[model samples]
Target: MRSFFRWLRPYGLVVYWVMLLGLMYLETVNNLPIPTDAEGAAFAQNFENDLSRNVFASLIEITCLYLILRPWSFTQSIGRVVGALVLVLLWTSGLFYVAFNADRISNVLGIHLLWLVVLNLGLVVILIWRVGRLLWRSLQQSRQR
Candidate 1:
């Protein structure tokens, strides 16, 4: 276990960025409306159904990109963790929104929205664990040094 974690330490940022990209892709792709119906008109109408989901999806992608590229000062690192946690909470809330408003999400877009919620939840758990482990290891290394 120690050896695995040690190996991960050097590549922690890389792993995090990869996971972030994956989450972004999942959220963006799943939120997009894919047409399965014979009527091409329905597909066109789907995009107009609701802009909220797409807006939030874009926000998430932008935030993820900022998290990956922005140089973090000590305080900023803490803020980033907190911000990530908040985003996860918001995504979970979206799940509840979908649950209560099932009628609003009965179409293809709705299914994709659910997928995005589930995927984001899993990514959140992985990210929290990874960040916790990295912080613990960093503290340990500092003590040893």
Candidate 2:
């Protein structure tokens, strides 16, 4: 178990957390401040139905995973691959439920929508930190080479 964690990069974990936080921010924005006017409500519903928040969230997850994981080489083990696939599927399912069934979820769970933009802005901070670390390490490796 320790070895498994050692194989993962710190930046990868950071990016994953950023992605999850970003998704939470998106959901919070989508649910908060129930639309009062007909035009605004219609726009919100249309945006949900036409854009498919699940698709956007999935794209962000995939892109972040690729960026964060591509630098490292992993052992081509079947178990690891299968596990990754299962995780991806499960994440997609959860995103779908959250995107489409948020009303029902909030009603049942009594969760309040607190859409603070600062939380979303935090992703930018994470990205900047990760990118700076990546560049510094790359430079160090090149100097050694």
Task: Write down the TM-score of every candidate.
Answer: 0.40, 0.30
Per-residue lDDT of 1-145 in model 2, one digit per residue for the tens?
8766565543544455455556554655665554446545322332333234434544565565445335356433234334444555455455446646653333211111221122223334544555677689889999999
Error of 1 at 103 (Å): 2.6
Against the reference, the lDDT scores of all candidates come to: 0.54, 0.45
How much is the lDDT of residue 5 in candidate 1? Answer: 62
lDDT of 1 by residue, 16-131 (tens): 54554455445445656654566543432333434456545545654573564353332214455556557766765776686566533434345445545654664576567667
Q: List the residue pairs that clash in candidate 2.
A: none
Backbone atom clashes (below 3 Å) for every candidate: 0, 0
Which candidate ranks first by TM-score, i.e. highest?
Answer: 1
